[model samples]
Target chain A: MTSEKKIRVLAAKPGLDGHDRGVKVICRALRDAGMEVIYTGLRQTPQQIVKTAVEEDVDVIALSILSGAHNELLPKVAGLLKEQQAEQISLLAGGIIPDSDIPYLKKKGIKEVFGPGTSMNTVIDYIKNYCAR
Target chain B: MDCLCRKISEEKERWVKTTLNKAKCDRRTDENGEDIKVLYTPDDICAIDYLSAIGFPGEYPYTRGVHASMYRGQPWTIRQYSGFATPEETNQRYKYLLKQGQTGLSVAFDLPTQIGYDSDDPMSEGEVGKVGVSVDSLEDMEIIFRDIPLDRMSTSMTINAPAAVLLAMYIAIAKKQGIPSTKLRGTIQNDILKEYTVRGTYIFPPRPSIRLITDIFAFCKDHVPQWNTINVAGYHMREAGCTAVQEIAFSFSNAIAYIEAGIKAGLAVDSFAPRISWIFNTGSRIFEEVAKYRAARRVWAELLKNRFGAKDQRSWMLRYHTQTSGVSLAAQQPENNIVRVAYQALAAVLSGPQSLAACSYDEALALPTEKSVRMSLRTQQIIAHETGVTDTVDPLAGSYYVEYLTNEMAVKINKEIAKIDEMGGAVDAIEKGYIQKEIEERAYIIQKEIDEKKRIVVGVNEYLVDEKVDQALFRVDKKVARQQAAKLKKLKKNRDGQKVQLALEAIRRAAEGNDNMMPLLIEAVNAYATLGEICNTMKCVFGEYRASGWSGR
Candidate 1:
């Protein structure tokens, strides 16, 4: 597993939502899965998240939002990544996002959207498999 | 007495070996990780002297209940925390709730408003009216409370960092309605310590944030005598996954800091202690929760009387509001949340809360629809009237198990409070990242337990389902942001700029010194100064708080 570089993932909360329980749990799970995880603390803007992901050269940016602002904030992060020519970094999200909003979020460049009750093992495997591909 | 104790112990031992072993009974524990014996008898609570330790209701060390009559004289207030979209939309919801027989109001402000931002600010983009109602200025406040007389209504605003500004707006609105400040009654979730640790809506650092709270305490003592100054909250921390024990201990530690800050600021303990109230989360563990509340009341009563040497009896009471735990709800089968909330609400009612807010069944996914919220309120009503649980004061007081559990919980809660006190106080512990780390660890453990299927959350880990969610969810209007931003722009342009500027300047001056901030805040709020403008003025003096060290790494 050390032969290849450790999978670097950037976990960010990109709005005024302070619901960090899901994000914190996932961060720990990813780290235990032998992946490097960087958690940008609460109340981060989309631009800041994109900048950190790009500067850190992380392979993925996992966004967690529960305040119902995913429709506006998630797309903006995806857009900012494209604007910065950092579209290589895969984008995924998990929170209270509805199933109906998944298609639109995917179209906006979020590859996957995990809602409430998704296990941490599922999230870690998704990242490992996504990075492998 | 000795012979009876020995006989009970022998009988319990015989039962454990014969009946318990035959049934293959496993060792059990409560949420606080305390071991529980299968059978409890007179020997378990024989050490407790009934007159002193388990006193009568409304007496000193209020372990049984706070009121002597309990729910017989007056039932608990049914207040549901709700709001979303524009002020007009939220006003309709409030009026609807009142018409539906809700006893009190609990306001849920939007994120931007909670964190002291105008709707038009860049930081507020996409978040204007999402989680709660958007209030940018006095105009928005008036519109929200329009035609609802403030003097008669008991409102609770869930605002922390910007609690001073919001309370001032409520006061100004009351004054406009020809009601005196003394006649107003309500509570502001003016707790900032929990904001730094659990709920992240803090604007300033701890020192100045607590200073603002003490200022409110002092001001309300003279002007708004009926107002509860601060609702020191453990509900959020509990929602973040702390045990019921940590919830009581941590909130009391935070409360001690506030009371000390008030006394340091030259206010007598009795003057502000009577106005101090609390909010705790009542979860699915019915027996443990009931015992937790009972233990909490006793600890708080003793803390006020023995530790602080308070002379007033009202100051010794631990009057609290209970909200059924939202974290316990499962999003898999949203309908299952109704039964969960009903059980939690039953636990809270049995524990004797001053008020209660039952989480709606559909809350795990999105904001609750009208139908879902009404069902939640009706859950409380059924417990009050039909269930007959509230028929007697402290109905479960004499049960051997509850009495024993209450005694055990009080010892553990006091031990935890002592640990926090050893770290100087809650403020110091929070600054050192001690409290945050503790809660994060517990949260991770709880999550892992559920993931491993050890914790059986119905419809989540144990009961699997493949049906899609089909409930009619309430959706916040996306256009509410644009409308609020435009309204804020117009209000800024139309108000007297000179008066607003003068009021903000006075706040700046008061914030820099030891002056009470409520009057200046009320003046600024009355002059149409935005919440952000007032908070920003103080921010220039107090600066903003940036959390460090604790990254959940």
Candidate 2:
């Protein structure tokens, strides 16, 4: 634990959905997990989120969308990150996304897709495990 | 006082120790963990004044019910609020709902529209018509209300930040339908205060948002006399995981802020107060919710009459719409939600709401399909027609436990409201982040409770399930973006561009001054101005709101 660097996570809401419940809860958990968290508030575009993740040099980039715009918005953000040469940052997605769409989001570079009932422990462990990987 | 009451109270201790010990059932507390006594007798509510505190229905204080007849004269309006995909699709849904015996129209606009964006805007790219109907301009509004006569129907638009723009669009549609503003009967969720405090759909900062809301109040008092100016909301706060007590207190405090703002803006109390209605969430907490509605009515009635000097009885009545709790619906064994919704609806009906929108069973998975939505509506119908629950007025009014809980909730809520008032009111409290923090703390507690399996949420917690979600879910059309964009482009190209520009200029000019912006808003939409155009004009004057000191964020 002493040898591990503090994980910097960029938590962002990448759509017009104002539902900050899930994102805020996750951010609090990440911070409590001894991670440095930078929260970009609601209505951030794909490019803006990716740029923030890059500029902050975050180890993990977490995105939440409840407005059913994940398929269109998630891929755009992931693609922009790769284009911006910030693909090293692990991308994760969460919120009211359907199970069927999880395969597409995963294929598009979202390392993890957390749904409604996913425990905070799972999220923190995922970040640690992903970092280890 | 009575022999049976005394015996019950005396025997309850022995009953708890002997019978209940074998039962091993825990004592029931509220969502906030407040004590709930096993049996409430007259001694429990001895402090309450029946006539003064718990007055008769339709009378002062309105603790029992708002109208004397309650549902006997007229049952609560069955309002199933929904929309998604596109305007045409939404219109088809609206027509279907109306044909299936729904009494009212409640519109749910998409995220982009709710936040005041056109379908073609870059901010609206992927969210064209996902959460609700997308109305880029008057064209969409026209399609939404086509062949549905405005004068004959009552509509409720679930919008907040851009409520003024949407209301104007509705007015324009009514005008085209040959209905005058005075004849239009409905409400606009023109509650920007709740948006700033709880929900985050706001476009302008609090000050200007209040100004816009007050403008609507003044404007509607004169023009749209039949319209409810604002549906002051506690539902969203409750959905955000506030306790029933906090929900009532915080919402009342917000309502107080609006009333004060309206009066300070030079409108008399009676003129606008009658149009003030509320929306509350009826959750799984059956007695607590009924008591919440009851307590809210009494508190509001007294506040209007005493605090604000509202002379009219209509102003004192706390008429509210109810929605069965969305948070209570679980994704696990989604079919279980129907039973949850039925009880919630029953609680709402027992407590008396002006209307209700029961959540569909499949809502926890995705947007409701036609079959699920119909079942939701039928849930309300069964309660209204077959359940025999609506046959009595204030059915639970005189019950010892109900009265005791109502009094308890009212006192607690009023105490909290007093603290907020001492802090200079809701807006100041929100800016200070007190309200948001309170809600966040409660939300965190509830979430943890669920996670730790302390609260048994049926299929979610205690009752485990190994099942697949095989329900055919309603998926939004991906092509809606392109289709709406093309339509918006064609409409912008074809409509009288000069008239639109001129109308937008009028709104910009109105935004610069203290003048009421409602008329200009209506004219702009009527002249084919897009929602974004109107909101942008105001944004130039009242720059878009950026939340600050958000410790949670």
Candidate 3:
């Protein structure tokens, strides 16, 4: 393993989804991949997550929301990232996103969407490829 | 023909020599240090005693199960955990669940209610009804179970930190219904120790928290004999990234601590041990998950009888509830969650849980919509009715592979328990961040395996396809917060202010003295003192617990 600059990721659970098994698993997967990950516990607001993303200067912001407020919440986070001029940070999201919402999320600048059954390798590959690009 | 033959031969050779070869490999170690054996065999379980280890269901040590008839007697209760928005809305949901043939009601309170913040508290802003049902006062609790009979239906409230307050409120509601407190049958997830390690919704330090728990245990034994004062949980810890063995070890350690605390408070083991229950998370690993449950029962029985010197068989038996793993559900291909949940539920039933909560298929995307929740309940219904898995108790009991794994699991878990005891128990381990760090490390390793493609998660990294489907997702109304805040304000306006003050002061005095806080808390709940107000009063006296090391800098 190269001792290169580790790809830093902010794994955040926005809104009030107290069910966090998927998020915890993903967080572990990313950390094991040798990426520097900051887990901001649970019940974070979209604004709080964006604020943390900016403060941590993370290379990617991964939002884990199973709370069905993704349509309202994801756009807000994307908007705040732009307003804060942190658009360089790739936005990735996981949790149950309906198929119809993927294009909408993509339109809002979420570079990749890793849904259930998406292997950790795919996420790691997507981040590595997207970040390099 | 020659060119086609050559290409075909090359493809066939590659599949036969490499792909098939790799597929047959055994015992691959994942990043989390978990061994993924190709297949478990009788040889793997050489140490198990057929009669002793895989005992008849509902027998001593309860390795196979606690009930000999198991699900055939009565299929595990289908208990769905749901609460959202305001008490009125939650009441509607509860009524709907009861109508859907759900055997028991499991309530989920919002963060504000859990942390003892009033609906109008600054921290409660924008989060009043986002996650769970919001209960600001006894008025809210009265409305939550409004027309429902507390005497008829068993309820499980998934609340900690403010668990005693909520329990007191339930008791007050029961008293108002002319039902003696002793007749109520329900459970409070008074598992505060797990909160610090995994769930993170804690109010006071370990000492005062354990005191609060012991107070409830002591009071319940004498008063609400039918009520379960605490549900020692490994569900959150497993969801938080612990291995199956670690989950059992950590949760049992927590249970031991609670027992020690109760004994210290001058209570006998049999007085409340039967009422002490467990909640575990059933995951994707079908056999491993089943083995974990069976192993848990055996470990608990040994610990209670041998270690604690308990004479009562009821004190030795481990009764538990199982919830499908929320962590295994994915955001993509959300429908796949249905199959995953079915497997988890099946594991729980076959492993022999007292009750099971199947997670909704839409859980990965949002709070479950009515349709999704129904489907979840239906999944359990199908297993109970259509499948003959329930016809036999511990159907997989005699399998050499299962018995061996159960024994191996017990040994591994006992080792961890010894480590925790050396560290002065679960509370001490949690305080020192040992448990938290270990879980985080394990979580990291599991993820690493997936990142490297060592673990195959269908629809996520492999067998990929670009397809999308629309799912009905639940959205919390923005109006929920405003409505809840208004109700809190109105309750404050109408309730007797002086009685509330006296009740609060009584609670403070009880906290200082050796008196149990339940009776005073019941009085406060009856006076319509808001949950936040009661918690704030306790916080002032007890102070909030911050992990000694986590400055977050």
**In terms of TM-score, which candidate is strongest?**
1
Candidate 2 Cα errors over 4 Å, as ranges: A1-3, B1-27, B548-553
Off by over 4 Å in 1: B549-553
lDDT of 2 by residue, A1-133 (tens): 4576888898898878888777877787888778888888788989888887888788998898888899999999989988988888999998888888899999999888987777788899999988887
On residues A1-133, what C-alpha lDDT tens digit does candidate 1 reach at each position? 7798989989998889998888888888888898888999899999889988998899999999999999999999999999999998999999998888899999999999988888889898998898889
Instruction: Give per-residue CA lDDT, model 3, range B478-528, as digits (tens).
Output: 888788888878888888899999999999888888888999999999998
> What is the per-residue lDDT of model 2 for residues B129-187, given as tens digits with 9 covering 90 to 100?
89999889989999988889999999999999889988988888888888899999999
Rate residue A6 of model 1 by lDDT: 89
**lDDT tens digits, residues B330-390, model 1?**
7898989999999999999999999999999988889999999999999999998799998
Give every prediction's interface RMSD. 2.1, 2.6, 4.7
What docking grade applies to model 1?
A: medium
The alpha-carbon deviation from the true structure for residue A48 of candidate 3, after best TM-score superposition, in angstroms, is: 7.7
Could you give candidate 1's fraction of true interface contacts? Answer: 0.46
Ranking of predictions according to TM-score: 1, 2, 3
- Against the hidden true structure, what lDDT does model 2 obtain? 0.87
| Clash count, candidate 3 | 20
Worst 10 residues of 2 chain B by lDDT: B544-553
